[model samples]
Target: MSCVQTIQDYGLRSLGFGERLLPREGFTLCEQFTLIGSGIIWNVYFGALALAAGFLLATVLAVAKQSHNRWLRKPAEWFIFIFRGSPLFIQFFFAYFLFLSLKGASSFFNPFTSAWLGALIVLFLNTAAYTGEIFYGALRSIPKGDIEAADAYGLSGWTRFRRIIWPTMLRLAWPAYTNEAIFLFHATTLVYFSGFPAWQQKGDALYYASYFADKTFNPFVPYPIVAFYFILVTLGIIAIFGAVNKRLNQHLPQEARRKLRIRPQVIR
Candidate 1:
């Protein structure tokens, strides 16, 4: 089949919209590219949704952890510690089974068994803890002078945080948070393998890549295709974060702006 035809057949195969069955034989280059590329949609879906939700929860957790009250601070600290210190892979398995148990208890908990809600919740909580730590550290690192200046202007509490502190914390933490995002995106590959069934083969990029590798007995072709797609996505992520980083830093003096660089070491 032509490349266009291959795409038409498998472009949405991961979503089960096009090809009813993946090619069992005649795994042409076009098909490999098309299916792998199509699978990236799911990866993006998982990463994007998880990151959006994570950021909101992370902000609240960060503030809570920074609070002076033990009631607020200790719980946030424990939550952050538990999630951040553990391996994400283990968290996935634990969450999947926990959700399954809950599903048995109540019908409203049904969605928790599926990847959409179950796996997304795991990713959400996991990333929130990681990102919350980042934001919490940034909150602590905010210049005392900045807060003093805000107080000088009669700003306090919500007004002070919303106007002076929060923006600066985001700006300071964003590069590291960008790395967190990239790591989280990479981490989405663990979802289907965590015992959450793909439910009609609608798995992410790595899922389909592994499937093709297993079927063809050729890891070279399909795995590299996954690598290529991931590299492109990593670059795309860097670009998007770079734009946000730029905007966040634009208010700073020219020399004060830190250039966004992908630091994989932070994740490790």
Candidate 2:
């Protein structure tokens, strides 16, 4: 088949559209690229949803962790610790079985066992713990002078936090948080590789790459395509976050504004 025909056939195969059967033999470069690209849909879905949902929970956890009240503080501390301390692969393993047990109790828990919901939940909680710690550090790092200045302006309670503290915390934490966001997207590859099974043949980019690799007994071609896709994703992330960082620091003089320094995690 022509490359365009191949594209039309497999472009959205990962979403269960276009074609149902994967090509079995004489795999061409175009087929590999098209099918693998199709699988990226799941990766983006998991990463985007988890990142957006986790942001709010992370902020709340950060505030709770920093709170004086023992009730709020202790639970937040343990939640962050448990999620952050364990390996994510183990979390996925445990979560799948846990959900399976719950499925026995109630039919409503059925969806929770699937990767769409289960893996997303795992990623959401994982990112939230990591992000909560980042935000907590930013909260602690908030300039005392800024708080004093707010107090001088008769700002207190939620209004003061909403106006003064929150923005500053975001400004301080954003660079590091950008790194977290990148890592979380890259981590989506682990979803199908983990305990959560991909229904039918639907899986992420890594899943498709692995399929090609196993069939051809050649890891070099397909794996690099996966990397290329993720590299583009990383660039897109950097562009978006850098723009937000600029806006966050827009009020300050250019010389006073902190430039975003992307330090990718070598080992998470």
Clashes of each: 0, 0
Clashes of 2: 0
The local distance difference test score of each candidate is 0.88, 0.95
CA RMSD per model (angstroms): 1.4, 0.9
lDDT of 1 by residue, 1-268 (tens): 7889888888988888987887888788888888888888878888999999999999999999989899999999999999988888888889888988988889899988898788998998999999999999999999999999999999998999899999999999998999999998888878888888998888888888888898889999988998898889899999999999999888889999978768663322
Give, for candidate 1, the lowest lDDT window spanning 10 residues: 259-268
Which regions of candidate 2 are displaced past 4 Å?
Answer: none
Model 1 ranges off by over 4 Å: 265-268
lDDT of 1 at 237: 92
Q: Estimate each model's TM-score.
A: 0.96, 0.98
Assess the local accuracy of residue 252 in candidate 1 as a C-alpha lDDT between 0 and 100: 85
Question: Per-residue lDDT tens digits of candidate 2, residues 1-268?
Answer: 8999999999999888888899999999999999999999899999999999999999999999999999999999999999999988899999999999999999999999999999999999999999999999999999999999999999999999999999999999999999999999998999998899988899899999999999999999999999999998999999999999999999988798878787777424
